[model samples]
Target: MMDRRERKRPAAQPGSRRRTAALLLGSAVLLAAALSARPVPHEVVVQFGDDVSAREAANALASLGATVLWVNRSEGVWAVRMPDPGEAWRLYDRGAERVTDAKSYSST
Candidate 1:
């Protein structure tokens, strides 16, 4: 007979592993839902004359690794859809200064 002071060991439950796996899956799903709940930023569109072709603007965006979501001509302008304002500024800054400099030089 065992001593009365000694505690008996409890048996391991069969579903413990399954319970742990389910908890992990539930946590992953919750994390994904939380992340996806945030809203996406709006894209920026730069418009030029319809005389400027989509191919021209697409090439400009491609230089910055941005996708051209859409391109359409309205009135006399061709509106280019860029991924977001950040990308728009990046592309604008990269080339705009040079064009401005060239125009100033030619005008003078």
Candidate 2:
């Protein structure tokens, strides 16, 4: 006679297959949602030296293909969306007194 341990296992319940299919569908939906999300744009706050004119700063940023969102002439700051990380360094090399991430800020 066959041992109890060697006997074949019972078939899965009818509802289990539906549950598995639903789980798989949910997972696929989640994956699609994640894949469809776009990456956040890179933004920077560039401060120019006192001697740099607003026109000069605007020209420089335009030459780098940056999208100027805002300009604070009194503070000599420009909020710009750069295409990539390397552009921040390029801004510095181009005459930015300081280059910092746009998200870096203090509420107070």
Candidate 3:
């Protein structure tokens, strides 16, 4: 006689095939939704210094419609607010950092 374990039937049956297909379709739909759903942040800038050079850079960035957070004369570098992690690189030349956090942003 065959061992009980060896005589066991296959896990999948023709009747359950439809259920398996439905489950696979459901998972695909969910994955697609998750991949497509994401938020895009708005960008702004906070310039530091009012000197000719600083003002020039500020004016250039102004056309982009970035909000000015602050202008500090004490520091010569400009502070631009990035809408997202991707745009943060735009401020590398002048120096960029997360306003809320201490993360540093620089090209080098």
Q: How far off is residue 69 in model 2, in Å?
A: 1.0
lDDT of every predicted structure (CA atoms)? 0.51, 0.82, 0.51
- Relative to the unseen true structure, what is the C-alpha lDDT of residue 76 in candidate 2, on a scale of 0 to 100? 76
Spell out the clash pairs found in candidate 3.
none
Clashes of 1: 0
lDDT-wise, the better of 1 and 2 is 2
In model 3, the runs with Cα more than 4 Å from the true position are: 1-6, 10-14, 40-108
What is candidate 2's lDDT per residue for 1-108, written digit by digit as tens?
A: 999999999999989999999999999999999976754467888888888888888888888788999887474789999876576787776678888888993323
Per-residue lDDT for 11-46 in model 3, tens only? Answer: 876679889889999999999998777544443433
After aligning candidate 2 to the native by TM-score, how far in Å is the CA of 53 from where it should be?
Answer: 0.8
Which residue ranges in model 1 land beyond 4 Å of their true spot?
A: 1-22, 29-42, 49-55, 74-85, 94-108
TM-score ranking, high to low: 2, 1, 3
Model 1: ten consecutive residues of lowest lDDT: 96-105
Q: Give the TM-score of candidate 1.
A: 0.39
lDDT of 1 at 28: 100
